[model samples]
Target: MSGAATSPASAPALVLASTSPRRRELLARIGLVPARLAAPDIDETPLKGERPRDYVARLAEGKARAVSRASDEVVLAGDTTVAAGRRILEKPVDEADLRDMLALLSGRRHRVWSGICVIGRDDRVRVRIVDTIVAFKVLSAEEIDAYVACGEGMGKAGGYAIQGRAETFVRFLSGSHSNVVGLPLFETRALLTSVGVPLG
Candidate 1:
């Protein structure tokens, strides 16, 4: 269907293949509202020896393809992770895990990587990986304890939320802030537009 013509009335609807409120809110900021929200059911376990970028890319594309899409629908999915060098820090399993993650991140720089995938109406898959480098000030045991007790980082990657109270810990950030939150808007909009998905 190369060079196929399409009409405005037949434009495909965008389907967001995630239920994360942060992602939904981020899309809204770009004036793109998904016609549907699907919670992608996929194993999120990292493959042994998989790099962070590859892991996120695989997960994002997996999610986008897992969702059932109609001929007139385009699916979008994303995966975000916090990486300290080659090590990937996932969501905290418990308070101790959260504390350890915070401690490991204290007074150091880490990278937040997000992989975004789009399954266009043509069934062509497009993926973009965006990374942001962030640095945290040295954290004391008291600060860790207080943050852990507050439970803000419970299910967050790297056991922290840059858009939340954890922002206080950030001494430097060198990339897309929204990527740290969940999705990278600049790349996302680009992917959507490239796929003929209309955006406001």
Candidate 2:
């Protein structure tokens, strides 16, 4: 006889292993509020010569593994990376760094890579990497300086937040918009449903 599908009530509660407000908000949009928030503390330093895609995937899985959870709880984690060619533009440390990142992205096409990891109650791990191509219009020196002065990209990857003021700078974007915001909704829903998380 075939195995029966897992019932929603029988599934474990979801634990989000991230402190990102954007991730939390995105989850709320799908009515999948997490049972608990477990921010994973780990070294996010990229390995020597690690590529952008690998970097994000490793971090997401690492975050999922770092969070403590009960056998009856599923864990979810995600990581986003902005890559200009092979270089990974991480969160800017200061205004100067933000300026530099924006300048590099000016009039250029870059890739936004978001990696999502879901750990089921049975300890099985599922991962998906979503890539979005984004192109920015030619930014003038004045524009970069003004945007940096606003201090919006301080903690955002690639020194910009797509859902904020930076959206005006985008000339073209092709891929999951939610992924650029921090989490990919379609992919996240699929992952959660696979683990028997109630989406409705």
Candidate 1 overall Cα lDDT vs. reference? 0.95
- Measured against the true structure, the TM-scores of the candidates, in listed sequence, are 0.95, 0.95
Predicted model with the maximum lDDT:
1
Q: Tell me each candidate's RMSD, in Å, in order.
A: 3.6, 3.3
Pairing residues by index, what is the TM-score of model 1? 0.95
Native-to-model Cα distance after best TM-score fit, residue 150 in candidate 1, in Å: 1.3
Superposed by TM-score, candidate 2 places the C-alpha of residue 2 at a distance from the truth, in angstroms, of 22
lDDT for model 2 comes to 0.94
Report how far off residue 195 is in candidate 2 (Å): 0.2
For candidate 1, the 10 contiguous residues with the lowest summed lDDT are 1-10
Q: lDDT per residue, candidate 2, 20-68, as tens digits? A: 8999999999998899999799899999999999999999999999999
Over 4 Å off, model 2: 1-9
